[model samples]
Target: MDTLNCIECFVRSAEAGSFAAAARRLGLTPAAVGKNVARLEAGLQVRLFQRSTRSLSLTEAGEHFLREAGGGLDILQVAMANLASRQGQPAGVLKVSMGVAFGRLYILPLLKEFLARYPDVQPDWRFDNRPVDLIAEGYDAAIGGGFELPPGVVARALAPAHRVLLASPNYLAARGVPQKPEDLSGHDGILIRSPQTGRIRSAMLRSGDGRETPLDLRARILLDDPEAACDVALMDFGIILVAMPHALPYLADGRLIRVLPDWYVDTGVISIHFAAQKQLPQKTRLFIDFVVEQFRLQGLDRRFSAR
Candidate 1:
């Protein structure tokens, strides 16, 4: 057995969490994948996986080896891809994850031009509003706000993930505008409850001159998703705190207005993340570069938090 081939099998199986899933990815039978991993274990004289009928997990040795060897294997794949890319056509299935709202409002529109330029590329994009484990899930890249960068991952910031108070003009006229963060307490607040904990997230609102005010959001309508809360806010229900990008269109066209525009909650930066390795597939690399360039052209990359 080729030692590198066995290493590939070991890393893929570890990431996929099942020999069967790795087999599908590697275009091998599940038994062949199992045998390859077994050969690797035999060669190393160590058990790499704790396996059962229902679950598969990495052994302590496996975890340690993956940290060291996974990058080498990925680099090998990148080298191979680089050789193929020398022909000047980047072709492969590009897998990406992004936020639902941002993807729909922003990235989805750019696909036509992206695909037209890289006609050989096939894009598989997932739009959801949750954290993703890049390696474990086998994603090529992800675009969202403030995902933790585990080892083997890096990020390029796209924009400030600033949250602003938004309400429909009708709602503001009806309830009166909040002159300060404290006034939000007197007004109805459409709040975002955490999906994991169901707790309404409290935030510190910051003013332009560096004043911070703690906001204990009083939820008139508590929801787990930002889109839903924004919808409620649009209906003149209450003031909603949302990502600045989400409120941009509404604020521009007069559907919604920003309250205390000088004050915002600095969540973090919205960024695109990818696996960091010595070498990378041309398809993934080119896609990341292109997205950043497009953001620059569109002025979407502006750091609203700074303003």
Candidate 2:
């Protein structure tokens, strides 16, 4: 009787809520997972789960055993993984998700170097704007902004998710510049509709001198995509709000100029999100560390600072 396999099946089943879901994660049949867990219960002389046709749940004794044994099992598995990874290389498919524009611009460029470093590691990267369910979707990690941190997930902040109002020179000149936040009421605004909430975002901005003002601008155009809003601003349609990374190049090349340089929407931080666990798989850990290092090396945090 492999007690270790039984323990693993028990823990996975407890977290996944059913034998079938645990089997999907463990690459085993539901019957096999159930058999292993049954053997484990028999050895311990206790029933772990109260199983019914509709649902599976942990009993009091089962919960106690899981609480006591889960961390130990994780440590043991991590130790084994560390040893295996040292022998040759960390070899596995690392599935990750990131925002489309940001991923294509920054993350995609770094993959060649990452692959060169770990030839055995395969990268399965999803470039998307839609927020993902990390655990339910079986992703190793995810990166972006404003994602709800589900239970048993953690985040590492890579950059400030600071947003700035932007407008092309022609638009500003023709429409008349908004000298103060209150003055934006008369300006043409291209607003971003939140994909998650399905509502148009109207925000207030705070200046360096602690002056906060509500933005009551008229929305001539509303869209979900930030990049598209930038394009509309470039076409001299209206003022649009965009992230610093997306707006900086245009600010430099003079395609777009800041509408309120000292004022910005303090959205939050752009974070690399992953499952919160004591011992992460080697490849996943490496990728998280690597991306954080890249942000530091490139000065993305400072450049995108809301202050």
Candidate 3:
């Protein structure tokens, strides 16, 4: 029996609460994961979990064992990753998570140069809007906004996640253009539902002079994705509030213009998240540096700001 493999299965199952869940994360069959855990329990002479057909829960001994072993397992994995990094080329899969629209608009363009520089590092990137469990999900890095900082994870600020109200010229002409937030009441409003909270986003717009006002609008259409909202606005459907990154292309080409130029929504800063380890894998470190440097060179920090 491989003690290390059994420990890994045990740790992942303990964290995930099911052998099936751990198997999904570890790329193993559920039976294999269960067998490994069983072997570990036999070797340790202690039952680790209370297993049923519908649920899996840790025994008191299992909780104690997890508390003692989880940190050491993380250290071991980090050390192994760093060892691989130090030996010649950093050759491995670099799994990362990011927003679909944001990643395509901004980060995807840098992939060619990134591959040119580090051909050995294979990029396995997942583009989605929802927050991910970086550790359990086995992501080397993630890039998005408003992720809660979990233990063993840290975030580096990338840019301000600023949302601005936008409209097409044709729509503004037909709707007679909203001169103030109060005028927005009559116009068709394209409101976005928050991906994180599953609720319609409501905000108070603030101007440069410290004045604030609620963005009171009678919603005509509600969409979950910002990209969809932007498309709807482009088709002269209505005015939509969207992040600056998603809205910038249309604004640049004159397909859309900011409705309230002085007022904007500050959702917080966009960031790149990764494991907070002293010795990160060389590929992960290199990728993070390349992205940050590119953002700096392109002045994206300034461009993404709505203020």
Minimal lDDT window, size 10, model 2:
78-87
Position 17, candidate 2: lDDT? 92
Residue 121, candidate 1: Cα error in Å is 1.2
Give the Å error, residue 182, model 3.
1.8
Worst 10 residues of 1 by lDDT: 298-307
Candidate 1 per-residue lDDT over residues 254-281, each given as its tens digit: 8888888888888888888998875779
- Which sequence of candidate numbers ranks them by TM-score, best first? 3, 1, 2
What lDDT is reached at residue 52 by model 2?
Answer: 99
TM-score of each: 0.87, 0.79, 0.94
Rank by lDDT, descending?
A: 3, 2, 1
The whole-model lDDT of each prediction reads 0.85, 0.86, 0.88
lDDT tens readout by residue for model 2, 192-283: 88878889876778787778877676889999988898888889999998888788778889999998788988778899999888888888
TM-score of 1: 0.87
What is the per-residue lDDT of model 3 for residues 17-122, given as tens digits with 9 covering 90 to 100?
7888899989999999999999999999999999999999999999999999987887787667667753466768999999998999899999999999888889
> Which one wins on TM-score?
3
Winner by lDDT? 3
